[model samples]
Target: MSHRFLAKQWSLIYVRDVLRVLVARDFKLRYKRSVLGIAWSLLVPLAQLAVMYIVFKEILRLTIPHYTSFLLAGILPWIWFQSSLITSSMTIVENRELVKQVGFPIAVLPTVTVLSQMIHFLLALPILAVFLLIDGLRPTLALVALPLVILVQFALTVSLAYIVATLQVKFRDTQYLVGICLLLFSYLTPVFWDFSGIPEPFYSIFMLNPMACLLTAYRAILLHGQLPAAKPLAALAVLSSMVLSSGCIVFLRARDRFVEEL
Candidate 1:
């Protein structure tokens, strides 16, 4: 029994080492052959910000105060969530060769994808910081809670990634479906607009969205310079845990048939 326990410990260590290597490779490959490289991460969002600012703020005349900070708080994380899900959904199918030919821990493919995109999300933070400063907002002690907010979002992303990756092994169309759904959902999220103006029933329902809660938490910290209200954070933490457990269970059960499906 002691020998078996020692072997299991080493096995976990080995898997962790492999995960690290895969994440590095995926991160590098994402920008390979691109002229702008990682700058594209910041550029894509900044370009979107420019369009939205022009349309909503200039054309429609939405009177949002400190709009850049508010919008960045939402857009950055939405990009992370959107990009992670879309990429991770295809990871299992994309690595079908590895899934079939190697004795690899297949579940780590989506984990690697999510972590690599997370690095992009983190790299884009300086842009947000610059916007905050431009708006004259200083970093506050509430910034300490930013990590907790990120952890919650990461949990939610990984959980969804696991489920999506597993489904993609059998359903090749899952990636396109994910992209379509995200495009539709973006309008529902409070990314470019203030949630305060939303009416009662819609407001309550919208707040239930994990992304809405997350972006609100981000704005609370970065835009308002205060820690988020405990209620939404607690709710998101619980939701993320439950979803993560379900995702892992689904992925593990489906993994055995992945090679055949591939």
Candidate 2:
């Protein structure tokens, strides 16, 4: 019975068109009257990389090779994950009026937020490539894994977004809570540091973080010019799939209550 209901709900014939329109609307609204427009997407992460480089590389002198490339590889994906979660958490609540309207799929609200932020993430990649080139690195065969890494991250991001969005409808504090968590997780995730520097049981524990594995994969492929090891990659794939499937089930079950809760 639940399977049949899920199929009916998932079979939105116009879902693609709706998603396209929502993504377009979000893009326009995001840059509506901004002077720099899309260039801000490139500049923001680059500016962040510059500051971190000076503080960590120059001042403190954390001796990671190709530091700039390493930072970009992690920062770009972290920005995507951060922005998607924050925005998607507020999606349904922000669109309460539309959500109340019949025929609206509440799930699409968070999905739109995820897709929109993903566009920004994709736009920032070329900047990462430029930094890599400036660091005297050329693309290698391992770069082929880049798309696979992105696919897994996207699944993970959307999965978490769905769950957060659903919960945020009832608990208005979820957005603020998500922001706090992102800040803490950013420092913990080895974005600026090397995983090898971590020690003992703590190192083993940090590996359990999905973002830790994904960021390591990005650094390995883009900065080190090598593919991530099979074991960690396989683990991340499985974790992402599990999260996506479970998140979808939770979102579908809670969706009908959104309007009532709002």
The candidate that achieves the highest TM-score relative to the unseen native structure: 1
Q: What TM-scores do the predictions have?
A: 0.94, 0.93
Q: Best candidate, lDDT-wise?
A: 1
- Per-candidate Cα lDDT values, in order, are 0.89, 0.88
Score candidate 2 by lDDT. Answer: 0.88
* RMSD score of candidate 2 (Å): 2.1
**What TM-score does prediction 2 earn?**
0.93
What is candidate 2's lDDT per residue for 145-236, written digit by digit as tens? 88998888998999999899988988899999999999999998988988787688998899888899899889889988899876987887
Regions of model 1 farther than 4 Å from truth: 1-10
Worst ten in a row by lDDT for model 1: 1-10
Question: Backbone collision count in every prediction?
Answer: 0, 0
* TM-score of model number 1: 0.94
Write model 1 residue lDDT over 30-115, tens digit each, in one string: 68889998898889889989988889889998898898778888899999999999999989888888888645777788878888
